[model samples]
Target: MSGRKAELVEQVARIRDLDLRLLDRVSREALTLDRNWMVEYARWQSGNWQTMSLYNDSGDPSDVAIRDCEARETTVLEHMPATRELLRSFGLKYMWVRIARLPANTFLWEHSDYRDLADLERHRLHIPLHTNRSATLTLGGARVHLGYGSLWRLVPTNRHGACNLSGPDRLHIIMDCYADDTFRDLTSNLTLDDNDIQWLPEATDGEISAHLDEAVALGKLGYHQAAEHSLLKLFYQYSMPEGMGYDLVIRAYEMMGEHARAEQWRLEKKVKLCLA
Candidate 1:
């Protein structure tokens, strides 16, 4: 296995069957708040997905930009007393805390987080408040249905995506915490077992052809970026040959008569995936 794959396997861990009563309460309170939940990170995301920041740098609920982390609470946190107490009980330094909601038929495109940072001293954790069987997280070529009442540590540096094919709004309390001795001790007993890993089947040639046809149709409809995102999402959804997604994106641009853009995506694929 590559170093990156090994890191992902080692970093992602789950502590199942935690008491999530506080998180449930917080999710209800979050729905009542009129705070803005728009996410600005990726334009490809559907509007059905929303995010509410509880803890951030300036304590501004509208500010969703990821920056130097802080522990200040936004206005949304005022009504979440139980959540506050629960987080404090961890006895670890906190950074950013947010609630992400994904309604039925919504999906987050495949992407990695915190790549711009030089030092990765913080770890991202997820506590599922509400989810369904159809809601799934695809990471490191494995599809996982994270059950409710569990704490999961996600490897933010790895490529990952999420989808809620059918749901009553999948909600999760996501936290970024400083990795300290306390955090290490908390996860000391947790081990990555075979049961925790569920590999997605490889995409058949027919499926790949159908995806390409859909991409072509999307481009004809002038949704070029969405078309490209769809192709890139295949990389996370199924096991494919290296650089296949990038090549498809380049082809999509070429078909649109955008040679410069096509070449740009080709080079981007090389740099991002470290393809020689």
Candidate 2:
């Protein structure tokens, strides 16, 4: 890692709250706009987690894979003037920007980002538009909610996952910005409140076995994906070593006589978590 990245990693650790002014106008406008969320990046998530790009490489909202490039505003931004203005106010070099929605019971499985991008300095920012307490981001053995009224910075290179356990959709404007002098200055100060963090404890062996049995039961009843997701959701609930949830999923598949799927998940775990 570069010196700048090393400093940033030390500052953020995993995730931190930023002391930026809130823009309620943008949040309100986001709720009223026509959201044409596209389902992409199936490998990183389970259930109804989707994205609609505002700024992307091709200026196409449907092109949602996050890549390193000079991003341009898509047609979706045309309907979101407040959001557009807010983006401009940041005065940072944006790589990609999108409106991501994670609906009820959705899960973004444990993974790291920027794994395939060039060795460049980039970071992610999140502004909550609409959300519920049940919606939380899990990383570093802690669950945190990036509540509205402030910007949240996440070092996407860390192993992490997210979930919305209950009803109602969780919406946020996510920005991937390349680091510059202005960006560094903007994030010179960050705060992580104890109240915002729920540190998870290590899952007991019995608890782990019970979850696996439940997942296996679900798989036997023809809810294979749900079964896998049930095990995957454990990452958000209790602390485990990296990729343990995926291992449980593989075990579930093996018990269900789906050896092919078991092997596939073994590979998927490595790929999604960037274990290789």
- TM-score versus the correct structure, for each prediction: 0.82, 0.90
Which residue pairs show backbone clashes in model 1? none
Show model 2 residue runs off by greater than 4 Å.
1-22
Q: Looking at candidate 1, what is the lDDT of residue 125?
A: 83
lDDT by residue for model 2 over 181-243, one digit each (tens)?
988887776766665677788999999999999999999899898898888888988988989
Candidate 1 segments whose C-alpha is farther than 4 A from its true place = 1-11, 44-48, 191-198, 221-226, 241-243, 261-276
Task: Report the Cα lDDT for residue 149, model 1.
Answer: 68
Global local distance difference test of model 2: 0.82
Pairs with backbone N, CA or C atoms under 3 Å apart (clashes), candidate 2: none
- Residue 131 lDDT in candidate 1: 84
Q: Tell me the tens digit of each residue's lDDT in model 1 across 1-276.
A: 555445545657675456667767755665566667866655435456777787888887777766656578887677778777766777877788888888897877555677565475888888887888778777766767777767888876666668887788888888888889988877665434455456777998899889888988898898987898789778657866566777888887887787997998877765554343
